[model samples]
Target chain A: MKRKISLNPVTRLEGHGKIEIFLDQQGNVANAYLQVPELRGFEKFCEGRPAEEMARIMPRICGVCPEAHHLASVKALDALWQVEPPRPAKLLREIMCCAHFIHSHTAHFYVLAAPDFLLGPDADPARRNILGVVGKVGLETGREILKHRRYAQDIQAIIGGKATHPVTGLPGGLSKGITPGEREEILSKGKSCVEFARASLQIFEDAVLQNKRYLDLITGDVYRLESYSMGLVDDSNRLSFYDGNIRVVDQEGREFAKFAPGDYLQHVAERVEEWTYVKFPYLKNVGWRGFTDGKTSGIYRCGPLARINVTEGMATPAAREAYEKMVDTFGGKPIQATLAYHWARLVELLYAAERLVELAEDDAVLDPNVRALPTAEPGEGVGVVEAPRGTLIHHYRADREGMITGVNLIVGTTGNHAAINLSIRRAAEKLIRNGKVSRELLNMVEMVFRAYDPCLACATHSLPGRTPLEIKIYDSRGNLQERLWQ
Target chain B: MAVKKVVIGLGNPILSDDGFGIFAAREVECRLPAGAPVDVVEASLAGLKLLDFLLGYREAVIIDSVKTGSGRVGEIYCFTPEALRETVRLASVHDLNLATTLELGRMLNLPVPEQVTIFAVEVADNTTFGEGCCREVAAAIPQVAEQVLVHLGIESATG
Candidate 1:
C-alpha cells in the first residue's frame, strides 16, 4: 500500500498556499505538489467598467504592488489613447516607480530574507525573524530602515496620491505635479536612499557574502534551478523598471526572446492546473515541459534574479558596478542559485536609488505640464513593468466609449509559479527521507519558496485569516496523523 | 486635553467580505460628532506598515475581518493584543506580524499605542474577489460600527 503525506497549511481561511506530498510504497518521497488558492474574478469583475477606472481600481486589488498596478494601468491607457506623456510626467512616473522598488526591496531584505542568511538558516524559530534581525543589526539600523522606508513612501505619496493604493496616473500623464520645494525634498531623500542602499549592500556583504558557509549555500544545489530568465530592458539592453521591451534569456545566458509589451501574448502562455486556482505561465516557444527546469523547458524564473540575468547591465554607474560584481561573483551570467535573489535585490535597490536621484535632479520633474489630455479613441492596450517581485503585465480592452470589455493580468508571482513549485518539490525530494520528516527539513523546504519571496498576502489579499505556514500530514488512508503550524 | 484616539480599518476593500472592516469604519466615521477627538484611517496594509498608522496615538481601535473557522458568519469579536499569540505568520512574506512589529516599535522607541483594541467581523468569503461586503457580512457592517462606537463611548445617531 502506498502512503501519502499532506502538509496542509490550509488552516488560514484566507487565500493561501498548501503543499501535499505523495510517498512511494517504501515511504520515500515520490512527488510533491504546491496548491495555491488564488483570489478569483478580477477579470470578470473588470468587464464593463470604465477603462480609466483601471488606474484607480487595479491598485485596490492588492496593497502590496498597487504602485505597479496603478502605473501599468495608466501606461496601458496611454497606449490605448495613442498619446505620449510629456517628458516631465514620464520622469515623475519613473521616479515614483523607483521609489516603489526601494520601498518594497527594503522591507523584503530586512524583514524577510535577511534573517535566513544573517542569523543562519537553522537558527531557532523564535529568534529567526525581523525582530531578531533588527536586534542583531542594532537599533540604529532598524531606525535607518524605518526612516528610509518613510522617505520612499513620502516620495510615492507626494506624487502618486497615496503611497499604498495610488491614484495619480492618468491616461496620457499624471493627475498631479510636484512643486520645486517638493522636488528638492524628494532629491534630498533620494540622496539619503543612495547612502542607505550602499550601507545595505555593505550589510549584505558583512552578513552573507563574506561568510563562507552562506556563500556556499547561495551557490549550492538545494535551491539551484537552471531555468530561462525574463525581464524588461531598454534599447541598450540595460535594466529599466518603468518601461522597455520584454526580454527573455535562455538558460545558457543567451537572448531567447525580446518583444514589446503588447507582444507578450505571442511569446508567453499560461497553463492552468486542475489542482490549483493559480495558472502557471511559461514561455510559448519552449512549450510546457511540466515542472522541470532546463534550456528546453518552458519553466522560467523572474523577479530580481531574472531581471539581472536578462539585462545587459544596470543603468546607473554604482548599480552597474554592483551588477558586475554580482555577475563576477557568480563566475558569469545566468546565475542558477535561488539564494542569489537576495544579492540581486540589493543590486536593484542601488539602481532604484540612483535612478530616483537622477529623476529628482531633473527640472522636468517639477514641470507643471504633467497631463497630456488623451483625444484618441480607446481600444486595446498592454502595459508591462518590472515590479519588485518580477514582470507585471496588465492588458485591457475597451470599447469606443472607454468601458473595459476584457482584462488580463500576469502578475509577478505568477511568472515564477512553475519554478517556485518545482523548487519546493526538489528540496522536499532531497531532504525528506523514508517516512521521516524533521523540523529542519520542513524549514529548508519553506526557505525554498521564501527565496522567491512570493507574497501570498499580495496574491491572496483576503482577510480573516490567522497565520501562515501551517502543515498537516496525512497517512496512506488519507487520515490526518500529524500537524505543524507556523 | 484628552488623549488622541485613532480608528483604523484594515483589509483589502476589493476582496468580497474582507471589506467589512472598511465599511464598518466608514460608518463609524460618518456617525462621529463634528469635533470628535479621534482620527479614522482606512488602510489595506498590515504588519510593519500597519504600525505606521498607529504611531503617536494614545489609543487605537482596529476593525478588520477575521475567520476563526468555528464562528458563524457575521459574528463580531472584540480581542485584546494578547489574544494573538498563535499569530506568527504575517500579512506579507515581506512584513513582520502585529506582535513583532509592536515589539520592534517599542524597542526602537517609536510611539506605539498601549491601549489598543481589535475587533474582527466573521465573514463568509474573503478569497472571492468583488467590491463591498457579501450578504450577511454586508448587513453586519452597521452593527460592527455600532460596536466600535460603544467601545469608543460614543452613541450612534441612528438609534
Candidate 2:
C-alpha cells in the first residue's frame, strides 16, 4: 500500500506552504511536492495607477520589507521620468537598506530560526518557539535580538520618517535631508549595532562549528545543490548589497550572464501553474525543468547563499576575511545545506553593519540638497533592489500624463518559490523513508521552508480568499490511494 | 496636574489615503495649545512598538486608517480603550494586536494610561501611489482635527 504524508501550513515562515510525499509499494519515498497557495494581484491592480504610486503602494504588499519595495518603486519612477537622483539621496537610500537588512535578518534568525536550533531537534512541539527558546537557551540572547531589531528600526524611523512603512524616499529624491546632528546620532546608534551583530555572529558560528550534533543536523545528507544561482555582484566582482549588476552563476561558480536591472525580464520569465498562485520564475535559457530534475533543466536558488557564491568576495574588509575563513572551513562550492542559510545571513549582517558605518560618516550624506524637483515624463521604466530575502523587480509603463498603464512586480519570494518547494519535499521524503514520522521530522521540514526565508504575504497579498493545501497520492496504476487535506 | 495627552499617527504617507493617520496627527499637532503637554508621533503599524509609546502617559489619542464595512470614506469612529478592547480582536501579523499589547502592558504593570482613545478614519484607494488623499478624506482632515481637539478638552483655536 502506498501512503502519502502531507505537511500543511508549514509554520515559522513568512507565508504558507504544503509538502506532499509520495510513497512506492514498500512505502519508500518516490516524489515530493511543495506548493504555496496564495496569489498576488498587485501587478494587475497597478495597471491604471500613476507610475509614482508604485513606490507608495507596493511597499504595503508586505509589512516586513516595505522599504525594499519603496526603493524599487522610486527607482522605476526615476527610469520613467528619465532622471537620476542626487548622490546624497542614493547614499541615504543605501543606509536605509542596510538597516532593513540587519533588522529583517535578525528577526528571521532569532525569532524564526533559533527556536529550532536552541530548543533541540526533538524539542516538544509546545516548547519549540521563541518563548520556549528563552526558557531553554536563556533570555540574554533573546533580549539581544529584540534590542538589535529595535535599533535597526530606529535607524529606519530616523531616515524614512517612520519605522515600518517609511515616507522619506520619493521619486525625484528624498523628501527631507539629514542634519549633521541627526547623522551623528545615527552613526552612534550604528556603532552599537555593529557590536551587537558581531556578538550574534559569534553565537551562530559557534552553533555551526563547535556543537557536533548541531553541525550534524545542519549538514545532513538530505541537503544537496544544483542549478544556477543569481545575486548582485559589484563591478569588481564583490558581494554588493545596494547597487550593482546581477550575476547568474552555475553551481561550480562560473558566471553565466551579467545583466542590468532593466534587462531582467529578458533573462527571467514567470511560469504559472493552475494548482498554485505562486508564479515559478525560471531562467529563460534553461526552459521548463523541475527541481531535482537536473541542473541543466530546472529552476535554481537565489538570496544569501547564491549571493555569496556569485560574488568574488565580501564588500567590507572584515566581511571579506570572514567569508574567506568560512569557505576554508566549509569547503567551497555552493553551501547547499538549508541550515547554511543561517551562516550566509550572518555573513551578510557583518557586511551591512560595516557598510552602514561607512555611509553614515560620509560627508555627502549630510548634503542639504537630498531631493531634486520632479519633472514627470511618461515612459517605460524598471527598478530592481536586493530585498533582505532576494532580488525584487518592479516594472512600469506610463503615459505622457504620468499615469501608469501597466505594472509588473516579481517579488523576492517568487524567485525562490521553486527551490523552496523542492527542498521541503526532499527533506520530508528523507524523514518518512527513514521510519515513523516524528515531531522532530516535522520541524525539520518546516526548517526547510524557513531556510528559503519566504515572504508569502508579500508575494500574494491580494489573493482574494484563503486557499488551503491539498495533497493526494496515486498508485502505480494511477489510482488514488491516499489523500490529505489541510 | 491636568491629564496630558499624546497623539500618534500611523500609516504610510505615500500610499494615497493610507496616510490619513499622519494627516490627522499633523493637523492635531498644529491645533494644540502652544504649552499643552501633547507629543505627536508618526509610527509604523507595529502594535507592540506603538504600545511602548503609549506607556507613561495620562491619556493617548491614536489616529489610524481602518477598512470596516460600516464606514465610508471620510467617516470617523471613536472608541475608548475599554470599548475597543471588546471589539478589536487580534488580526495583525505583528507580534500582537493593539488590545493584547495594552493588556500585556497592564499585566506587566507598565505605566499604561487610564484613558485611551482611537480615531479611525475610513479610507478608500489605499493602494494608489503618488496621489494625494482621496477627495472625501482630504476634505475631512480639518474636521477630524477639530473633533480631536474638542475631545481632548482643548479649544479649537484655528477654526
Candidate 3:
C-alpha cells in the first residue's frame, strides 16, 4: 500500500515550494520531490533591451539577491565590451560584494537557521522563529545583530547607492568614486563587523557544537549525503566570491574540473522534469543519473558548504583560522553533512567581513581612476561570481550597438535541485514510519531542505503580503490524515 | 515640527500587474503639492530590508500587490501590519519575512514607523515578464493614489 503525502507550499522558505513524499506499504519513504513554480519568458524579455540595462533590471528578478545580480550583470557588460574596470573600481565592487555577503548571511543565520538550534526543532511552530531566537539569546544580542546588519547595509548604500538594489556599477567602472572620509568610516565599520562575525562563530560554538545531541544530528547519516561540490576559486585556489574560475571537486575531495565562466557550457547542463518547472543541473561529464548521489551521479552542490569544500582555504586570516577549525571539526575535507552548510556560512561571513576591512584599508581604494572607457565592439560574454547561496553565472549576447540579443542565467539554488530532493527523501525515510507524519517528523524534513537555502522563486518576485505555509498528510487509502496551515 | 511621511511603492516595474503599486505611488508623487512633507520612493524588495524604507518615519504608506483568491482584480484593500501578521506566515528560506522583521524591530527598539498603512491592489498577472500593467490594474492606479491622499487627510487637486 503505497501512499503519498504532500507538504504543499513548504513553509518558511523563499519563493513557493512544495514537497511530496511517497510512502511504502510498510510506511517507509519511497521518493520525494521539491517542486517550484518557474517564472516564464525572462530571456525573451531581455532580447531587445540595451545590454547595460541588465545591471538595473536583473536586480528585480529576485529582491533577495539583487546585489549579486547587479554586479554579475555589470561584469557581463564589461566582458561584452572588452573593457577593464580600473583597479580602484574593482576594489570598490569587491567591497560592495563583501558587504552584501555579510548582510545576507547574517540575516539567514540569525533569522532563518538559528531558530531550529536555539529553540528545539520540535518546538511549537509559533515559538520556532527569529523572535523566539531573540527571546532565548536575550534582547541585547538582538540589538547588536540589527546594528551590525545596519552597518553592513550602510556601507553598501554609500558605495552602491542603495543596499538592496544597487545602481552604481556600469560597463567598465563604477558610476562614482568614494572620498577619503567615506573610506575611513567604512573601514571603521568593517573592523566592528569583523568583531561581530567572531562573536557569531562563538555563539555557534557554544550553542550548537557543544550540544552532543545536536552534534550527532548534524553528522548523522540522516542529514548526510555524498555529492560533488562546486565553487569559484582564485589563482591560489582560495574561495573567491567576486571573480574566479569555477572549480568542482568529487565526493572524494579531488579536483574534477576547473573552467572559466565562458566555458560553462562545456561542463554543466540542465535537465528538465515534468513534475516541476525548475531545471535540475548536473556535471556534464558525469551525466544525469536521475537524482541519485555519489561518484557516479552528476548531482553537485553549490553555496557555502560547497564553496568551503572545493576551495583550498579562506583568503583572510581570521576566516582562515575559522575554516581550519571547521575542517578539523568535520575531521577532514568534503564534509557531506547537509547541516554543515550553516557552519560553513558563518566562516564565509567572517571572511566577507575581514575582506571588507582589507579592501577598505588599501591605499588603492582612494584612487580616482575608476573607469576605462569601452572601445571594442560588443559581443557575447559570461560573468561568474560566488553569490551568497552559490555560484551565479550571467551570460549575454549583444550586437555591435550593445543591444542584448540573448540572455541566460544559472542561479545558485537551481544547481542543488536534485540534491535537495534526495536529502528530503532520505530524511523522510528515516523518520516517518507506518504512515505516521507528525509535526516533528515534518520539521526534520524541512531542516534538511533549509540547509541548501534554496530560493524557489529565484526569478518570480511577487508578494501576496503574507506567508502561506501549508502541510497536508495522507494515509495509504489516499485519505487526508492531518492538515496544518500557518 | 513637520510630519515625516513616506510613500513607498513596492513592485517589479517590469512585471505586468505587479507594477500597480509603483504606478499608483508615482501618480501620488505627481499630484502632491510642491513642498509636501511626503517622500516618495519605489522598491522591489520586502522583508527585513523593508526596514530600510520604513525606519525613521512618523507615518508610512506602503502600496503593493496582494493575491487573495476571492478578491477581484483591481480591487484596493487597505490594512495594517496587524492584518498581515495574523494571516501570513512569511518564510523566505533565503531571508526574513515582514512579520518576523517587524517583530525583530520592536525587540531591538528600532525607530520603526508608529503609524503604517498598506494599500494592496488585487493582482491578475504578476508572473509574466513585461513593463505595463494590465488594463484594469492600470486604470485603478489614479484612483488608488487619490485614496492615499484621503488617508493622509490631504486634498487631491482633482477633488
Score candidate 2 by lDDT: 0.73
TM-score of chain A of each: 0.96, 0.92, 0.96
lDDT string for model 1 (B1-159, tens) is 778899999887888887877888899999887677889999987766788899999889998887767788888888865566356343332266566778888989999998888888888777777887878888888887888888988776765
Ranking by DockQ: 3, 1, 2
Comparing only chain B with the true structure, the TM-scores of all models are 0.91, 0.90, 0.93
Per lDDT, the best of the predicted structures is 3
Q: What is the interface RMSD of candidate 1, in Å?
A: 4.3
lDDT of 3 by residue, B47-158 (tens): 7778878888889999988777578888889988777767766454336666667777877898888888888888888878888888878888998899999898777765
Per-candidate DockQ values are: 0.51, 0.09, 0.58
lDDT of 3 by residue, A1-486 (tens): 777777756666777778889888887788898878767778899998999899988988877888888889899899999898999999999999999899889888887789998887888878888888889989998887888888999998888987678999899999898999999989999899999999999999999999998888887788888899999999999989999899999998999999998899999999988888778889999999997899999999999999999999988999999999999988999999999999999999999999999999899998988889889999988988888988988999999888999999989988778889989988888899887788789889999998887776554445544446666667778888777665
- lDDT (0-100) at residue B16 of candidate 2? 69
lDDT of all the models against the reference? 0.84, 0.73, 0.86
* Most DockQ-accurate candidate: 3
- The C-alpha stretches of model 2 lying farther than 4 A from their native spots are A1-4, A22-26, A374-376, A459-486, B1-159
Worst 10 residues of 3 chain A by lDDT: A458-467
Cα error, candidate 3, residue A362 (Å): 1.1
lDDT of 2 by residue, A1-486 (tens): 566666655555454456766677777777666666553345566777777777777777656788888888888887888778899999999899899898888877765777678776577644555556556545566556666777888888888887677777777788988888889887987887788878877877665568888887667667555657888878998887778898888767788888998999879988887767668898887787666535585486788877877888887887787788767766885667767777788888888888899899999998978887767566999888888888888889988888888888887788888887777667777876643655666667767778778775442221111223334566666677665543
Using lDDT as the yardstick, the better of models 1 and 3 is 3
| Model 1 C-alpha lDDT per residue in residues A1-486, reported as the tens digit of each score | 455555544321123566777777776777788776667788888899999999988988777778988989899999988889999999999999999999989988888788888887788877877788888999999999999988999999999977688888999999889998899899999999999999999999998888999898888887889899999999999999999999999978999899999999999999988888789999999999888988779998899999999999887999999999999998998998998998999999999999999988988787899999999899999999989989999999999999999999898888998998899888888888886777778777777777777766654443334456556666768887676666
